[model samples]
Target: MPLDAKTLCLGALEAGFDTGYDIRKAFEDGPFQHFQSLSYGSIYPALNALLVEGLATCDVRNGDGRRDKKIYAITDSGRAALKAALMEPLAADQLRSDTMFAMAFVHLMTRDQVKRILDEYARANRRLGEELGRLLRDRMCEHPGHQFLLRLGEDGSEMWARCIEALRDDLVAALDDTREAPEAAPTGGAAAMTARDAPETREPGSGSRPGPDPHHPRDPR
Candidate 1:
């Protein structure tokens, strides 16, 4: 089953992200990044729910000459809930990427467009790896498990970037050999496509072929 935004918020609170904004960042680009994602829209509601359920506490404090800020912290109940959730059967990992989904429809794109997409994807992956590396260098993750996870994500991202860069030219070359196929080509293989692409139907009774006539007998000789 998919993890809910509320549960993720609890994890972020326990991880020392005391503010709603910080919680969102944790999933966007901090420790929770790469493994999980959360949107601000979901984060705020979850935080509210946590407070209501006594799973978390919040403190309002003075801000930089502006509205006060609310700092969130997980309660004992929240920690226990997080622990229980983790111990349950975990969901299988999935690769959720917009770039990857776009790549699957490459036939709809031009060669130049395809090149740009590949280049951008590689660059983004490289950036992610570097960011993770910086976190490790700054000693943000102290525990061995935390370090291990960051290192793993960093290495995996860097390796994938390299793989994409290496295979780009070959993928482009292969794509060049194949013509674009119709987006809505029916199933059942090429024959089905052929039937779909056949000449459009005209009037129900209108004869398309010329009728044989005595005046044009003997093959019109």
Candidate 2:
């Protein structure tokens, strides 16, 4: 099931992010990096909805000639809501990636373009892996479950980076082979090979035990 922005924001608050910017940053730099993303477009409206529902409160902190900052905090009602949500049956996971889609049609792209794409992909995964590793090394969490989740995220990021690097090497070698055999016609076997070598469309988070589904009302577990 798709998670709503509002519940994710509430979870961010419960996790100690006090501002909308901080909540969004948490998604980019924290555990959510592995599985989900929420933009400012989603965040601000979610924050507003939470306020309207009386589940959270916000205080405006004036800045120096820039935009004022709003600090948010969960209320008692918000805590209850979060607990209820967490206790509910977890939703089915959904994975969506434009990178994977582009890679599926990689045969149509030039070697240079493929190189650029692989370089960018490797760079991004490497950065995420490094950040996750640093977070695990420097920060300590009291909750065993949270710690487990953090470790899982770190492992996933590192593995993804390594896999992407391996793919980059393979692609480079394949391109070189193709250049050396320019007269050879592309074969059906090549299509089969590409299909076999393509990355899994589903992301890493799907197989994990279910968590709360924020979009729907609680159902009996």
TM-score to native of every candidate shown? 0.73, 0.66
Name the regions of candidate 1 deviating beyond 4 angstroms: 177-221
Could you give candidate 1's per-residue lDDT for residues 1-221 as a string of tens digits? 86788899998888789999998888888876989989989999999999999999999999989988999989999999988989998889988788888877665666778999999999999999999998887867677877898898899999888878776776575455443333354557554343333234332452423244412132233
Q: lDDT tens string, model 2, 9-105?
A: 9888988898988988889877666667898999999999999999999999899899999999999999898888888887887777788788776
**All candidates: CA RMSD in angstroms?**
15.5, 12.8
lDDT, candidate 2, residue 32? Answer: 68
Q: What local lDDT does model 2 show for residue 138?
A: 78
- Total backbone collisions for each predicted model: 0, 1
In order, the Cα lDDT scores of the candidates are 0.78, 0.73
